[model samples]
Target: MNILKKVILIDDDQINNFVCESIIKNERFAEEVQSFEWAENALDYLKNTAVQQPEAFPDLIFLDINMPGMDGWSFIEEYKQIPEEVTKNCCLFMLSSAVDRKDIISAKSLKEVKDFFSKPLSPEILSFIKEEFICS
Candidate 1:
């Protein structure tokens, strides 16, 4: 099933971004995938793209919780201010290696986050998300 037309990966780790991007492409999860090493850049891109070209907004976003400038949590705080047109249709998922319960609880408490997942996104989890959230 076609779940996403575009997907974005916001992670500080270049290797993780590469792997995630490859996975999304190889699994045909999205027609386009954009990876960013900085959350600030991704935020700027999202806001600008929404105004300049709303059609380019991603349908799905995988955000890492650990980063230098703006962490995943901070990104969400700022992201909430963006126009609804830019975020309404996008599904936000927190991607991190942190297993802290507080983090998971915090993630779930946020309305913007659809769900939380451990790092190294897998096909099984991807399929599950697509089936549970996107396909349904």
Candidate 2:
């Protein structure tokens, strides 16, 4: 079963968002890609959306670690406000350039984040995502 479908991209970096969105779309990995420049807006979207219907909602989320405010870390903390269904079925990956071991450890601690990948995202990363989350 193809698990990649509607996806949300939350990153303050415009280039990162553009590149990832382009890659995801060009590869037909996600049918829809919604982007947010900050985690706060992304959170607000999640908070208002009905994710219980997994087939109709976003299948995954790509969150960025470094942002002006409400970074990926902060967003994860506030993600508790979102419905449990949203957290259960959908996948969330931490896409960042941070090579810091501490950051890696921190991301691993978050139950919502399925994988921590360093950017810029390539075909291999995309494939891994598909194999791990989409096909699993």
Highest TM-score, which number? 1
Cα misplacement distance, residue 49 of candidate 2 (Å): 0.5
TM of each candidate vs. truth: 0.96, 0.90
The number of the candidate with the highest lDDT is 1
Return the number of clashes found in candidate 2.
0
Give the alpha carbon lDDT tens digit for every residue of 3-98 in model 1.
589999999999999899888888889988999999999999998988899878899999999999999989999999988867899999999998
In model 2, how large is the Cα lDDT of residue 60?
88
Model 1: ten consecutive residues of lowest lDDT: 1-10
Which tens-of-lDDT digit does each residue in 1-136 have in candidate 2? 2347688998888988899989888878887888999788888778767654444657888888899988888898888667776567788899988899999998988777888999997778889988877787
Candidate 1 lDDT score at position 81: 91
